[model samples]
Target: MADNATSNRKRCSLNAFISHAANTTDVVPEFPARNGPQRLVAAATKQPKRRQKVILEPGHSALDWARLKSSGKDLRGVPQLGRYTLTEIKEHRTENDAWTALNGKVYNMTSYVKFHPGGVKDVMRIAGRDGTKLFMLTHSWVNFEFMLDACLVGFLVPE
Candidate 1:
């Protein structure tokens, strides 16, 4: 009887100790007091650091031909011969002489028509017309300016 009671007491004590330890093990410590240099260091470490400002070197402007020509200054001696009106652009609508107007620029796409990823028919459909909307709709992500840079015949003059 006495031994049974002692065993029960030991079991109860062990259970109580285990419960207390479980509770303590799961608890997170409170943050350190907020007035010291430790707190400042903690706060600083928690925040994201400001990134250094990137100083990019001046590079080529893709579509800003006016700026490029003006900056060169000596471009005045280079006689510009290929400015075309809409009527003139319309004259070159065949596959052999395919010209396309996109974003106020005229591109002679005769050679490019054969190599078009979408098909020559797509290029032919927009020949000699302002295909800006269709071009953006079909290939808004394509860098047409860069791709057609070499094919650029001239700027489109107003009707």
Candidate 2:
């Protein structure tokens, strides 16, 4: 009965060692002989692939501005919308006809007023006025030139 108790204790100790090793390592240890020791072999692990960063040049214009340039008589001799006075811009103040000046450029934002992410009130607050300061203060990172290309009315006439 003493030999049986010793054999049971040895088996329990071997099981505890194998459990600890399997939990700590990636591979499971194999025991060829039931009464023998445990041998652990590590399993191969695949490392994650790293991604390379792409750098773009400064002042990169994604769109071709040359294509949008007016050439024919469709412009009614205006030749690229010319320039607009503050008084002319102020004429479109209501929600039905909203216009805004930003960075010396005029933009007819009537259609975009309701669709503004910041809300119509925010857009209306600067209607028919120089919104360059307010625009930069709130959303300096926004690419207005590319996003509002179709909404552009003209450049502001120099004072």
Candidate 3:
């Protein structure tokens, strides 16, 4: 009879110890806290920030462009918005003063060429012409509207 009682006590003690250990995991961490899963998902989903092969000059980074946009510089060049014929737009082709149309909106792309991810050559190719097709083909993801809002010259009207 005594042996039976001792056996039962040992079994009960083992179960109690297991239960305590299981419950203690909630209070005492088994492993360190980490966002491992979140970081993996983000790394998989996030697109590359820069697609350019050429390195940008100092003070001409993407952040610099954002700062330049807000700096109150007259990026538009013109006093007010007005329709521009393709002929007139062609005249402003130089890197010093470039104008191009994308999605029917004309933007003064002079200052932006330096900030371009694809370097000046890529942006210069679109100068003084309708770059909607080329721009879309190269970097369709680019949000030109938002990027060039401050540099907006006007709409591109038929000549």
| Candidate achieving the largest TM-score | 3
Stretches off by above 4 angstroms in model 3 are 1-52
Task: State TM-scores per candidate.
Answer: 0.49, 0.49, 0.67
| Candidate 1 lDDT trough over 10 residues, lowest sum | 54-63
**Between prediction 2 and prediction 3, which has the larger TM-score?**
3
lDDT of each: 0.71, 0.68, 0.91
Cα lDDT, model 2, residue 17? 96
lDDT of 1: 0.71
For 52-158, candidate 1 gives per-residue lDDT tens digits of 44333334233343355335443222155477788988888888888878898888777566566555676688887777889998789988887776667788888
Error of 1 at 107 (Å): 0.4
* Model 1, runs deviating above 4 Å: 1-81
Off by over 4 Å in 2: 1-80
46-79: candidate 3 lDDT, tens digit per residue: 6967854988999999999999999999999999
The superposed Cα distance between candidate 2 and the true structure at residue 124, in angstroms, equals 0.9
Give the range where candidate 3 is weakest over 10 consecutive residues by summed lDDT: 25-34
Candidate 2 lDDT, tens digit per residue, 32-60? 54444432222234556664433333322
